[model samples]
Target chain A: MTSRAHIAEVFMRGLYPVLIIASFWMLLRGHNAPGGGFIAGLMAVAASSAYALIFNSSKASKKMPLLPARLSVSGVLVALASGLPAVFQGLPYLSHPWWTLSLGGFKLSLSTVMLFDLGVYLAVWGAIGGICLHLIETIEENL
Target chain B: MILPVAPLLVPLGTSLLCTLTSNSVQLQRKISLLGSLLLLGTAIVLGVQVADHQSISLASGSWPLPFGIEVVVDRLGALLVFVAALMVLICTLWQMGDVDPAHSSFFYPLLHGLVAGSCAAFIAADLFNLYVWFEVALICSLGLLAQGGTLKHLDATLKYFALNLVGTLLLLTAVALLYGATGHLNFNALAMSVQYVNPAIMQAVTGLLILAFLVKAAAFPFFAWLPASYHTLPAPSLALFSALLSKIGICALIRTLSSIFHPSPEPLLSMLGIIAVLSMIVGVLGAAYHWDLRRILAFHSISQVGYMLLAMALSTRAGDAAAIFFALHHSLVKAGLFLCAAMIFKLSGHYDLRKVGGLYAEKPGLAAIFLLLALSLVGIPPFSGFWGKYLIVRECLVQGEYLWAFLALLVGALTFYSMMKIWLEAFWKPHPSAGWQAAKIVKPIPVTTGLCLLSVIILAIGLFPEPLIGFVNDAANHLRGHAP
Candidate 1:
């Protein structure tokens, strides 16, 4: 029993990094392809849900660390934060900011609008997951 | 930037706060109210600024146009934002004391989020961004409507969910096709690329998008889901939903067709004309026979939307302006009437016109408020509603569409009868049952007072509409591509 629990814990820990990477990749490719914030968020939430089911939810939640509730809030904050500079720039809100930084061999362009999309992905994932978690906890208590 | 974007963000930020503190009802209400006030203030400030300066657009993250979601603050979008914000704030206040603190708190955040989402939908330049906003609004609405966890409420919400999903899916399909055809989702880019696309594909895309929007707006053949779900929600929630949510669909339709597709005047205009006449007639007829006060009001919401669509269908400057004005007028009047109905429910414990009577004797102030709102609904002069209907009919007459103009006027008369039916049954007649007399009446709270004041503002606007008309004309000119 102990071994089984330990293995599940290890597997859950390993899953987060992969989920996080996959979400970013999806978001980056979204503008041109079918992969966007909504789908990427679904990916993140699906991974979290999987972890919760494999390990104890309490452990899975602690491993995830950020409460889905807080993440939900912060995701919106990040989205708004990305748009705030535009407000100061005398433009409308959520004005995407872009500056291209050239590396020795590669060009990396950072986009506030892209960041906003990531925020949306995280927020949706966290929100839906958090609500589901809360409901599950309540149902378990009642049972 | 002082654009529609900030208004969208305010509620989204507050929604997060609400979710975090979902455990505390009182905390939620305060936060919600504060959030709503912020949005309302932002909208007013932006409206003034835009009225002075003209249209504004902020590209998120400084991405160049056609690359990122562009938040627009043209005259039309800003005005709708102002009206939506006002409705949300009033509905929030009206429900404040009446709702359980916990529920009320939950209610406000979601309501704010819904408003923000709708505002975003109205101004979004990118199709994908529009989808995101639509989802946010939809999820929040589902949460608000299902808050009670009652079987009936859940059932109603589930149906709403199913219908919304289908509508959204249709929207998604249209977006996919548009992207496939042009490899661009931005409205401006798509419009430029549309002429290059095959005629058959363009027609399909237009049909799909229109169908999706019609379903969302609850137009004649597509309106069943609205009445079905609305009848089951708490009064305040239903009022907000009716007043705001459906408008998102109409907004999207207007933006897509007017800005992107830019369809010719012949087929599209005639089809919309037929749709408007059918919707107006059917909606009014539905309201006339309904004995339940809430359902009657809900049905009229559909009818009023038809009036707005009639103007939109014309696709002229006068048409768009009237659509915008009518949308604002209907949102305020409908919201006020629904909240009034909610208050009456508290006093009489029944919403059926047949059972609810003598309300005026017990709650004269409330009854009077409802009377004023209903009058606005029927387009009485010195009210905002009058301006919208008059402008549209006047334009129709000028265009030599005498038959549509006459039908439009007839719809107004029918609307008055529907309003009168409610007044006579729910307010004038003596209580038919002993239970009504025994029902306890609650006095208006400060929040309720705020709501009433908001309604008065609508009256004020009607009494002095010159400035608003000027703004509308400016907005119309911008929409007509007369201004860059």
Candidate 2:
């Protein structure tokens, strides 16, 4: 294994929490703002990749919660399933069905569009993470 | 309303399901076969609906037609989708016995993705949506072509990837230019706005778009990647590629020429015709020099595409009808031929005609099927290919383009020669070994059943051309902007 700089490892350890929170923030604001599924997914991937860089890939992969392919498959299924409810209601495919909720004087808006975005988030994250991990492993092996 | 989008949805959903179930090969195969059948049924229903109403257009997000993505099912699109679904079904069934276990996990997902992309491209009514679907199809195909992970497969995949990227870049540039010139991206809206755009800008856009599609379609001068790479992939993948990938390009060409650039400029028509003729001649010539069965078929695919494009170049209702008919017929026959080649490779352990022989004596049924598909491909009478070629030649004669008609016939004859060469070399010659007895054949049922199914379809179409002729004529009229 390649030796990691002590300072860099410490910095990545500190950065993970911030990155995760930032990605979720981006995901939530994505519907009305510039930040959405794609950007948020990239952010999450950046965080994970940073972890891989700081530690070795073998250790990092064991730490991962789900396989990248499975994550992507579930993401796609969720996105596709989100579209189904609208079809069942006689709306067109991917037609957003929205509802406004009152939660203790606060308005909470929910819709299938956000669910689709979330699915995209997971799908993109999984695809990029999986590819990055594979490449890193190959490079490490070559080294 | 839902019918317009069902074809795309079925495949997309199946692809996702396949990805989820990629761990189990048997399950993946079963799901894919079921999905293809559902898709075929959906396509047929959509065809009938289109016939009843002339066309069906659905805005995917329930947005207005101009702003939302539109999926339109007309006679031509429906017919192509139905044929594509059928081919996918056959290929999936063939894949059961053909695909290696190592590749099975990802193959079905990629196949479904490709099917979805092709179906979406066929019905896409917006320029950007078409581009999206093209990317989807391209990525899946690249994955498939590289599935074997051999050095040669990797090299072919790289070439395919690079050339196709260039094509996609050119298409994007053209779409951008078109949107800038007309300020519309939807097909119907663009058709209206294009008339008012500057003629020179429109001409440039048309040229670039045609060039991009030609590269994808693997026409002459841009077709080297096809022959270089297609023969290297696994048989079932090759069969699927033969059936759908280039045909998608042809479908796009037909759609663009008839709808977006109707009343085509004289120079454009002539240029397309020249390309068509060259593709036909050059493709056949290339095939004549190759002794590999798959390589020959790959070259012929280029030649067959030329016939479809030649019909489109005529820019008349008859031309449009003939182009659609030719594309559908060629997809089935070419795919059947590839599947047969796969069977030959399976039985003989070789793809080169020089090393393979005596198939006529050993496997008479397989030999007969090969003859039927090959004869059809050569445009012999009482075959599906004959009807398509007859229509295009007749249309050319009607247009007083005797040179084009003559060239078409000459290409047909050359195609006949190459097919005959394969037959003589591979089937008629005695087996090279003195003690040649048939080894125990393993699982011949799927391939045999698939070949027989294709043969019956080819024969039925040949014997009763009236239904397909009338259907394609209606589809042609629709392309001419008439509500038949």
| Most TM-score-accurate candidate | 2
Q: Taking the tens digit of each residue's C-alpha lDDT, what string does model 2 give over B353-458?
A: 9888888988888888899999999999889999999999999999999999999999999999999998888889997877766544566677667778889999
Provide the lowest-lDDT 10-residue window in model 1 chain B. B96-105
User: lDDT values of the candidates?
Assistant: 0.78, 0.86
Q: In order, how many clashes per candidate?
A: 13, 0
In terms of lDDT, the best-performing candidate is 2
DockQ of each: 0.45, 0.62
Report the lDDT tens digits of candidate 1 across residue range A65-135: 47887777778777768777767767656656677999999998876777788778878877887876666
- Candidate 2 clashing pairs? none
What TM-scores do the predictions have?
0.86, 0.95
DockQ of 2: 0.62
Label model 1 with its docking quality class. acceptable
